[model samples]
Target: MPLAKDRNTLRRDGVQFSDPVAADTLIFAGALVCLDASGNAVPGATSTTLKARGVAQEQVDNTGGAAGDLSVESRRGVFQFANSTSTDQITRADIGSECYIVDDQTVAKTSATNTRSVAGVIRDVDSNGVWVEI
Candidate 1:
């Protein structure tokens, strides 16, 4: 099928999102975040089952609440995070390659034997940290 005439399309910036936080989850502002198996926001960590969402926009404490009791605002874009050490460290050659979540603020070169989930692609690496296109 094809458009018969004119049509309107909805558009968005595609960089930000607001999703419900997982129960007993405490997401800190500026920390890397991910969605768990149930699609609830949680701090990014070395887990093979999590999907990297984005950086948490603000702190949201759901320690005393159930799932969906609160929401978290996250922004998706390129961000810098700490690089893993030793065998897990990211190097300049790893640019444009995929990285894994080491923690809320760190990424590694590999998935640590599938014990970690994909963080994002490496855009650049510097003395400070790895710039990830999440």
Candidate 2:
């Protein structure tokens, strides 16, 4: 007549131990929270503001879906506009093209116009033109 061995045991604090236990087993003592790069909780970061690193540029998309136009070039990075007090000023030279942050806005060119709106950050300004980050 041999005594039976207890295969599993429970500690006083609610931890469980068993025979032939795994070495790599992870035990969760309590709840865990996740955070973002800013060290803020991910869930609470929904409203977090992202600072723009460079100048602001408005995207101009053609509305008519035409294959060729200045607006198309603007959207494709060929041409970009700088922020102005009333409107976006187009410039070929990089002078006075300091990067600025701006909110999104929509503009109607015309009834048959095929231009759309886009927002992006400025990457660089040169004598040729200003580059935007889409």
Candidate 3:
């Protein structure tokens, strides 16, 4: 069964699992990251770049003498992903709107000017941010 808003801790909070490793440098907390061709996580880049993956749950640095792959908590399934809005500015109507990957940590509500890859949908909106459900 699907979890309700109140009971959907995994949905609203994050139903995460540590799987993919960082493609290169370490990623910071709350950064909207994406997957590389190798299935490694990298900061969400432009539409012409990386594919939208998920919001990082925490930071991980596996480089610089670390011989192990850095793990990240990727939110899979239905979950809320918070991200900064682009220059377009977000509004309540943007809620339930389809957003696209703008940058490493940002999403845009409009694709009229840019034909970026679809990241997810804006399920909720705030002053300058939106909750995307991927």
Candidate 4:
């Protein structure tokens, strides 16, 4: 047979118990925590402790510009877009000095006037290269 013991009898002022009991035995300990009036953590309270398990932060790229038809030239050259007509061209230098466009589809540049679009998500970046989820 098993019996329930009072919390005060099991634990003294600041002492805990360390004993083995039968598999079917059961013991109930007092509630672990006390709450504040505003439902916030209270100081100098030792009932329950909160800890952060894991944390993660992400960097998002949100460079916005007017969507236009563009073309790629050379092997590692920047991007160029047509203004109004196909004959009128706008170079990357015309946009901004620090503006850089990346081709999301193909890793290798094939043609001088290749017209294409890429659809994917940036996976990660490192010293070697960038990884894309395509």
Q: Evaluate all candidate structures by whole-model CA lDDT and list the values in order.
A: 0.95, 0.27, 0.66, 0.22
Candidate 1's C-alpha runs over 4 A off are 1-8
**TM-score of predicted structure 2:** 0.19
**In candidate 1, where is summed lDDT lowest over 10 consecutive residues?**
6-15
Question: Over the stretch 47-110, how does candidate 3's per-residue lDDT look in tens digits?
Answer: 5546666777888765652322677786644334445444566677777777877675667766
**Evaluated with lDDT, which candidate comes out highest?**
1
Q: What is the overall TM-score of model 1 with all chains considered together? A: 0.93
Which regions in candidate 3 have their CA more than 4 angstroms from the true location? 1-14, 64-68, 76-87, 112-115
- For residues 9-127, write the lDDT of model 2, one tens digit per residue: 55553222111111222212211111223332111111224221122122223334322231111112222433333334434342433333232221111111222223233455554
Pairs that collide in candidate 3 are none
Which candidate's TM-score is highest?
1
Error at 129, model 2, angstroms? 12
- Candidate 1 residue lDDT tens string, 1-134: 99999999899898999999999889999999999999999999889899999999899999988999999999999999999999999999999999999999999999988899999999999999999999
How many Å off is the CA of 11 in candidate 4? 57
User: Which is the winner by TM-score between candidate 2 and candidate 4?
Assistant: 2
The whole-model C-alpha lDDT of candidate 1 against the native structure comes to 0.95
